[model samples]
Target chain A: MSLAATAATATAAAERGFLSPTGVEITFVLVGLVTLGAAMVTVTTRQLVHAALWLVMALGGLAVEYLLLTAEFIAWVQVLIYIGSVVVLLLFGLMLTKAPIGRSPDADSGNRPVALAVALAAAAALVWVVVDAFRTTWIGLDGPAQGSTEVSGRFLFRNWVLPFEALSVLLLAALVGAIALSRKNGGAAKNGGAAKVDRTAKVDSAADEDSGTPGASGKEQR
Target chain B: MHLAYPAVLAALLFCTGLYGVLARRNAILVLMSVELMLNAVNLNLVAFDVWIRDTLHAGQALTLFVIAIAAAEIGIGLAIVLMVYRNRGSSDVDRLRDTAERAEPDAPAAEKAEVIA
Candidate 1:
């Protein structure tokens, strides 16, 4: 082959390699951008409830990213656990605390600039480290999907069973501890005064009212 | 595809969460920030799992454990925050500085005893 033809072929091959983004990669980038935006809103929103809602979006986007990455099981688990349960739990906590439904000026501190600076520095360092470490690595898409439930389950049960059981215990302990902590300040408050108890009960009822009409109605039914 | 995309995304998410943790006063928001960080870690784990091509899927298994731990953490954290709000009427971490106040009254007596001893 002529040198000119050889150079042209080589250039064509390089162009083909560089310019083609697989559908999965494009989807990944789009989902990542969406997730990032949602995360930003979750952090910066003035409304506490809105932040929680935005968090749902962020978590949901992560699930979609997982799906695009071909981790269907992990994606579903992310959806089921993080979005379905955790966000609801957070909303419950919000209601239980009687956090304002609208804008919460106290949500943000005066340290935003400092925090931003630190965050930017940290992010830069992390990205640099990760990209530098794995610059040329490519995930094989043609092989048996490594992220399936069966593979993950086998891996978890076979090798990680002990830690998995330990996690169950930890979860149980956390559940009990949470119940203990959030239970009414019974004995401590009883020592104060009947009037004080009544005032607290009234405040609790008022907070419940602010949560929603259903909660208020439930209290009345009780 | 390179692993850098997801890794960098995770880094950004983690940094945003860190900023939220540092800049937010609301205890619940802080917990949310913590969730963000945990999610970022999960992303990194899965990305690395795929990049390294571990047949055992060890990274995803660990990610599962991390998720479980995160759930537990949030449960206990939100509970503690609720208890604090119940007692103090606000979830602002700044206002909870008085927790050490109760121990302050005994400090002087202890110091005096120490000096005498």
Candidate 2:
């Protein structure tokens, strides 16, 4: 090509700036906003169960944001693990602890102003740092998708197989630990079998009271 | 497509989780807040992975590991919290401050008297 033709093409390409906002970018921003709102609600709600449900909304919005970013695999994983499993686990914790179904007085400490101030300060600092660091960077959507499952799976197995396997072991340990911690050992006693029977009877009465009045029994113990 | 957008969103989410951790009294709520923070970190990883155009996808791989770790953490944390509630009848963080028992005001004097006797 001639020098003038080469210069013309370079100028045209330069004019097509990478940071130009498009429909996808607009949608991304909108979804991010919704996710932020949901997250805020998740943390601020007084009802523990409602907070868990709002967490689902926040996580779902994040999954949508991931999809918009062309990360389909991570998005689905977010759905399956976060929305499906994690939230359910949280709900189970709430139920197992007999947490109050309505507004919980203990949900918020008397430090809202302080917490809000700290949160705002930290958020501002983080936003400033990230924006300054990546002021003009953009991802090209025309290339091969970077977050496909096959590519991620290959990358994970090739370079990160050790950590992946270690994570499974950690999960197994956590399962064992959870069961051990939550089990009611009615038969183990320091003072022999008679003491064990007494302890079991007391525990059974407490359980009956808890069943009759849910969280009220816990409150009375205080 | 701007990296800053997702990065800033993640930051905001993180700060919200921080506030929840610091200000909430319920251990379960605190655990939920921790999940929020982890999700924020995941968002940051994915955002950077896309921006860097990393062929190896190291960022996403780390994010997967993080998710697995988070699941494990929640499992154990909830178990401990449930155990605490079962024993104490309440999961309030403020109420679980009996880790170190305080000496009674008269304990030292009583001990000295016993020794002298």
Candidate 3:
């Protein structure tokens, strides 16, 4: 009896049974719930600013989830990019668009019922499929950190260097496009204004290209 | 850890984003929903990377790439939204119907006549 008990215990330990719930798993679930709740509130909130704030919470919770998953570099990058810049950009967008400070009631469209039904159906199908597929799958997080800085840097530079450079180029292109879109149609307004607009566009693109790509690429180090 | 947790979470999050995208009237809110969807994809990528432990670490690499792409997308999206708001004085997605088909019988004929002229 004693020998069998010892054998069973060892086997269970080797198996890393997750039904019992490891510490990491528990933390992950708890954080996931918070993240989901925040996300729900973000989409459902009446106040525009509140929605953006709730988005910050949801995204910050995701960053924590990344940390829990042992992707420390990605976690920090998420915080830096999503929380730091993206949320701020969204807030700026809200303010620039003149979103109401208080409740504006028409936040949701007329097709909300249809939207909810579609989302529910999608969720059900996706959950069923994912759970069925990954029911027995397990992630063994026992060894050295898989997503540490050195490891990410190694694979990033060794294999993904070309794509990394290409992404930076893409970012540069996006910046130029943004400048083009945001600049007023000065040319259409006044013919002489076209030269003025061209010079300003050049300056704006140069400034953005000089400062923006590096900040994004620095954290987005793939 | 069981792979179902992150997978399920990501699926739900993506669905929530989908609902937001379809339901939200404000273009900025729609953009927010898009970000949520992208984040869900990133989570799924990271979880799968951790699960498979690929020699190339393709999942995490792709996650980073997705993040970068998402950033670029948001910038361009916001710029477009801003220009739309400036032009039309409102950022409501449903209100923008410049390209929508007209229900009137003569509208198409009139358009064709203009084209012919």
Candidate 4:
């Protein structure tokens, strides 16, 4: 259906020009702006947990972009996998790392100016190239929904079966790793500090002793 | 929808992630930046899938695969970060510089760095 629509646009180019913005285009741009802003905040926030929360907004905005494009299955999957699990897992990681509850002054490294310059340069090049290349191309969302469950599952099982199986194997490997983590946790529950110190002795510098504890090594470097 | 919208958005988002990866101090925040980059690519994939209308739906399928790999990667990455924190008692990416090129021609520092690793 989208194929037909693209073909139709060849003759109907005048019907949908860039000057005449569609509702979907307007919504996409607005959401894209919000997503971009949230992403900016996620990277810039001083508080560690706030970065994770803002990441949720950025990711959710992308999910909305998926819905606007009429890729229903991908949209739902974005919600389920990204928002439901990834962000929560990130929060858990922050907690496990004992991130500062209040704003940590040294959230960003000293190379922030360099990072900003590089990011801006890259964004400029990419946006310019994309807009110049695809100025006339159009995506048709009016067709029978493309990314429905039936379509995704069928294509996945048929054409993408091998990669799908390999992915499952990878998940199995992750599960095993998770189990190892739990067992390690249980063992470390007792004398965890001792185990950590023993490891730290090998990994950290001997001079680190003159410094504060190893936990403060991060700040010491800062 | 104009194809450029998603394409342009993906490009901008990817760059934002690049900045995050470069500027963030904590390893976990770096990982978050990596997630942003991955999500931008996923958005691009879904958009192209809708636009091209391929018979096999390769774009969406690939997006799913990317998501799974990202999950596994984050798990392993966190494990490594946690291990670093346990040994060094910090997750700062800038600190654990045991193997950095020695400025001085001192043999003892090099030897110590070698032993620590």
lDDT of 1 by residue, A1-222 (tens): 345543544454444442477777788888899999999999999999999999999999999877666676788899988998899999999997788998977789778889999998998899889877755545555567778888778888898899999989999999998888766343322222332344334432333333443343345555
- Candidate with the larger lDDT of 3 and 4: 4
Screening candidate 1 with a backbone cut-off below 3 angstroms (N, C-alpha, C), the clashing residue pairs are: none
Q: What DockQ do you compute for every candidate structure?
A: 0.35, 0.39, 0.41, 0.52
Instruction: Give the lDDT of residue A146 in candidate 2.
Output: 83
Kindly list the interface RMSD, in angstroms, of each predicted candidate in the order they appear.
Answer: 7.2, 7.1, 8.3, 3.5
- lDDT, residue A12, candidate 3: 48
Tell how far residue A8 is off in model 3, in angstroms: 17
Q: Which scores greater on DockQ, model 1 or model 4?
A: 4
Ten contiguous residues minimizing lDDT sum, candidate 2 chain A? A186-195
Just chain B of model 3: what TM-score? 0.88
lDDT of 4 by residue, A47-159 (tens): 99999999999999999998898878888888898889888888988998799999999999889999999999999999999988877777778868888889888899999
The true-versus-predicted C-alpha distance at residue A134 of model 3, in Å, is 0.5
**How does chain B score by TM in each prediction?**
0.82, 0.84, 0.88, 0.87
Top lDDT hit? 4
Model 1 regions lying over 4 Å from their true place: A1-19, A184-222, B99-117
Off by over 4 Å in 2: A1-20, A184-222, B100-117
